[model samples]
Target: MRRTTNRSAHRAGRAGRVRRTATASGAALALALTAAACGDGDTTGPASEGEFSGQTVTVAGVWTGTEQENFQKVLDAFSEKTGAKTDFLSTGDNVSTVIGSKIQGGDAPEVVMVPQVGVLNQFADNGWLTPLSSDVEQDASQNFANVWKDYGTVDGEYYGLYFKAAHKSLVWYSPDAFAQAGVEAPDSYAAMMETAGTISDSGLPAFSVAGQDGWTLTDWFENVYLSQAGPEKYDELAEHNLPWTDRSVVDALTTLGELFAEDDLLADGAAGALRTDFPTSVQKVFGPEPQAGMVYEGDFVGALVTNDFGRTLGEDADFFPFPAVDGGEAPVVSGGDAAVVLKDGKNQEAAMALMKFLASPEAAAVWAEAGGYLSPNKELDLSSYGDDLTRQTAESLVEAGDTVRFDMSDQAPAAFGGTAGKGEWKILQDFLRDPSDPEATAAELEKAAAAAFKG
Candidate 1:
């Protein structure tokens, strides 16, 4: 359910400007790993002086727009207090390329904003990240979820700390539209389908989806499968212990396929949606005289809509909890960004200090206000947030105990996630085109998943 409110939600727009200023203002871009030594290979605490003194620490991240701006504010505050110069490297595009070059050249930044937890493992495996035992111990609750922490740990040492969480299993819709249609939010999967059928019977698309990026569809499948099979099976699939052809997995795909088969159920045709971008599809659902009645996406989709389309979050759309699957445990699939300390930097202490500071409630609040992200820091009092939607999102996270971590396609072994991620979307598209043969589509996807996960 896309959650829309009548109240206007505010967000920062200074990300690009702040990044440009930070990068241009006297801070040097550290040489790549090849040009610099791995900093004595010492696992000791940060240095107190010399090369670290008056030295600028380069921080690389993929966050852009308001998220980047929010982080920049925090970094600016850190610089003001600590006198440690900082350089901002905004690698919005080609992040892997840039990070790979830095690690290979031995000039990786002191801290990096990692988009996926799996990347931390890959970095640790490649000796590109330092174990952040001190940081984790100092800020215990702010560390990664048990699953992510365990996954990110290399040789039993933690290397990354998550800073925020996004609730995915959320279905956003227009309350006014719902009222107009005289339909209440569905509480069960069967009811949800019935509601969709009713909405479609009115000649409106029941769900708004853009499958062009493929990841959007993947998100839907992940949420449904996670809800249907429960977290245990979800984890098994993530670890490749469960076959993609498992009955539960096929059932989930079939369920989604049935939704697709309903005429005019989705904003665009299955093939057209497969080619539409996320924002575009979302607009079709939230635009004036919305073409679709609902959209299933993460909490952050609100941000994308408000930031890009000048749409007010609360006034334009609202979200509801995804209905419970039949005889399945209710669990939310949550995704968020994390911070990591890169190896081979001179200002390690300063960077760690900055990281610890950023992990604090104060910093989290700053981020929440600036970027509209839900702070992962338990110590943060989210009540301070002025925006109702942001506060609601924060409350939802707290209310949801033990959320399942988001499965990034980049997190699994090289070929597994990326290939399977793409394959899942294709399967969805194929199933949509011919609902009579969901089993066949599921079988093809199972074969693809098997080959992708093959050792």
Candidate 2:
């Protein structure tokens, strides 16, 4: 349970939002919350006494498989506390398109788990999201950092409450590979490249490139750009206030080229990489045969390596921070799914209740105890996390405070940041294939960004 005192005024404002009224039931809920705090048997608080007994709250999101199952547990906890039936609708990859169609067809879900900040902004701007009530805001303020609030806010009203978070600046590698190569986890960009070269020189490909997934390329560019140009410049580029052709962009690309330019450093060369999707890329490094020595991605890769490949984190597989660049500190780039209420939903009251519950440490603990999940809730006990690596990762993000940033691509419009074979994604993949001309790549990026940001 890390804490920060920098946002005192913001926290004060949040504290002023709403105060709990004392009723017999409210007092009982408070007692239950206190007992839950003491690590008692009932961790999720007491079941509601027929509050919203017949209501069904539908939640739309992109989660499926294990992720869907884990999130359902959180919803179940909410249901138990509020006495409402909860239904989850998986919208697959095209969340915005599916949700938009549903809204237009008068069939919007009561809540939506939005994955991108840009998409959340679009929804909020279009008046499709309901403004969260004061009680919900106060709960969010108490349990989450101000940055989470900032992400969910639109024109001074909070809407989205982030439930699941991803720390995206990790580089996973095998300790055995590093030992065989006679190298160590790096502290700087140059050292990481040297490590890659050493690992490759030892008869294994040093890195696995997920070139087919254009979003991964965007992430590569973001980590470099953030470390090189710093936060203000990062914000400028993400918002398109600064052109992509700016020298900062070119510099970042050039720094990234230190790795991308070396064909020997990447597994199966650029052609093979271009055909590889994200899961295959991970498999190349941690799979049964182990084609490569390392892979870079978010903490989610831990789950894949542990579950699919039968590797143990901190043993067979582990991660290091994305190394520092140009004498600057490494930046923490993060992504998350925000929970927002639908403006036209019939279960507004129950939806708001769920939102409040989603903001609590108790709800966060549910997912944290389940593997492969991270929470932005500041008050969540680190012990709630199932393992040390997971707990440390969550602690790092929560303690990063003002220094932490959302994924740069996720902050941009989907056309530029998310779509495959288009905009930043395509431009970066092109850059990945041909690192000889970063200037031209920057120009292409500027062109795509200019067009996308105009919308």
In the range 1-455, model 2's lDDT, one tens digit per residue, is 01111334332322221112212235223311101111111133335564666777778888777787777777766666666766677788888899899888998888898998888888887889898888778777777777778777777778888888999999999888998999999989889988998999999999999999999988888898888898778766777879988999999999887788888999998878899999999999889898899999999999998888999889989899988898876878899999899998888888887777777777777778877899887777788889888977887777765566789889888889988889988887888888899999999988888888887
lDDT of each: 0.63, 0.79
| Candidate 1 C-alpha lDDT tens digits along 197-275 | 7787777778887776666676777877877877667766765677777888788887787777765777766756666
Which stretches of model 2 miss by more than 4 angstroms?
Answer: 1-48
Cα displacement (Å) at residue 451, model 1: 3.5
Model 1 C-alpha lDDT versus the unseen true structure: 0.63
Best by lDDT: 2
For model 2, how many clashes?
0
- TM for candidate 1 is 0.82
TM-score of each: 0.82, 0.90
Clashes of each: 26, 0
lDDT of 1 at 263: 54
lDDT, residue 35, model 2? 10
